[model samples]
Target: MNAITHNTVPTYQRISVKPLAVHIGAEISGVDLSRPLASEEIAEIRAALLQWKVIFFRDQHLSHAQHVAFGKQFGDLTLGHPVFGYEPGHPEVYSVGRDRFKSRFDGARLVRPWTGWHTDVTAAINPPAASILRGVVIPPYGGDTQWTNLVAAYHGLSPALRAFVDTLQGEHKFTPPEGNKARQEFVSKVAATPLISHHPLVRVHPETGEKALYVSPSFLKNIVGLHPRESEQLLALLFEHVVRPEYTVRFKWEEGSLAFWDNRSTAHLAPVDIYDTEFERQLYRITLVGDVPVGPDGKPSVSIEGEPVAAHSVE
Candidate 1:
């Protein structure tokens, strides 16, 4: 496929949310998230998501059913929290709740402390393609989700670094980094599922055919054939590169707002600043199915682009 020369402008209708970008994301208005969407409208929404990596719908009054139905337009749904139970009659919906409250049943924490940059289910052999998250109760301040454009990050790499990373394989597992006793305990109590898988460092977008950096600091354990210290340093550098502010966008959440993001080409972090407070933040999330990852070189491996090149190298 030919490279996309200019970004595609989104065609909008009836909605109030303004378009945040031309190529990848939009904000829709004048619609209630609680209500059902028409077939044609759903099609338009899907198209927007495909071109833009994210789409935001604001001021929605979504019921569990409404949220699930909206997500179904994109693809098959996956169950949230392999261990924690779901809301009644809505098996696909995962409820995120605050940690301060004691519940009769098990529920995942929705507090700010849990916010970290990650893609949904990178540990899975086949991770989700997209995710739809609806804010239920939001904090007064200090909880926002930030997303990075991996495609742009990858394109900025030098050809030699790109080629080197294209051939390397990295391991992704559920183990929390050594140290941090509190987090380790939390992981054990959650009975968090551990997954081991391999993915290419550089991945080709199935639809757009653009290459993206696929590494995440949270899930990736090490690159194959590297020493522990070396792996840690290398992965840390790559993570910093992918998360540079210029390639990222931050979205502040509002009660009744919904954000849909493509897990394939983006990595996100939820900021956790509101700690030890009465304020509670909750969100409902749904993950969609994805295929096994493949690299730009047509290999079943991952790659990382190193430091920027000298100015002379460009000309």
Candidate 2:
């Protein structure tokens, strides 16, 4: 259960909240990024994440190590990615930038990597519970990210549909970004692992006990029990509804800004407008490992291609 913070009591106050959207996002002010956080501060931050699915910070520029430190206060951190490589000597920090991608795929025709919304690592049995991303370089215009509240999406569905989906499961596959097959940065980063996993269609959030629609356009392949035509139709209907404007909030990025989101309750879209241009945008991400997702029926997710994330402590 979430511990409530009292406005009358001043002892627990340290951070200020400026909501970015009515439903899903908030901008947290008054915390220093360069230094360690107090236990009280971490508590409020976690509470804020529970109240609002995603939170943001402005002008709190953080180094790679600082980013990881902030994420550690939440829970055990995961390697940057299951198959995607991270910066040398810092396996916890996944580097995302234009120059970095170009260096890896020298002569390939590159396009914007994100056109859809997704959770951090749904292909694994234990996808990331949450993530902290810091913007190192920002483009002048047209590089903004958005997140949707799956909890809201699930509630928006009709009663009959909700009951029907509650008993179903879906497959999430780790495929490369569209347009370039074997030439994509992610596919060639490591030996291609056929990462696949089955998760409940409606996941029960371990923290808040909220049931969120656990579907994404990027990783979801099909509904497990339905026919091929039925599966595609169901997926298409849910996918279109998940990103409706009422359930989402968009963030305009600036250098030194950071966004922390609950991957278990939200799905995000990477900016695709800056493709085929001179503009460059870069960011660093740290993912916190989470428990396997449980459906409304109380079944835990299972993996096929990789091992589940185990808990760990690191400085």
Off by over 4 Å in 1: 1-17, 21-25, 30-32, 83-85, 100-115, 182-193, 301-315
Error of 1 at 217 (Å): 1.3
State the lDDT of candidate 2 residue by residue for 91-135, as single tens digits.
888887765544333343333222468988898888888888999
Which RMSD does model 2 reach against the true structure? 4.0
**Considering only N, C-alpha and C atoms within 3 Å, which residue pairs clash in candidate 2?**
none
- In model 2, which regions exceed 4 Å deviation? 1-12, 99-115, 177-180, 184-192, 311-315
Sequence-dependent TM-score of model 1: 0.79
Best by TM-score: 2
Residue 215 lDDT in candidate 1: 85
Per-residue lDDT of model 1, residues 1-315, tens digit only = 111122233665644446574334568666655666775566556666666678788788688888887776667776664434456668778887665224322334333221256777676666677889999999988678788778887877788888877776688755433332334344653454445677877778776787888887677778888899988777777788887777777788899889988888888886556556778889998777666688867876332321111111111
Backbone atom clashes (below 3 Å) for every candidate: 13, 0
Model 1 weakest 10-residue run by lDDT: 306-315
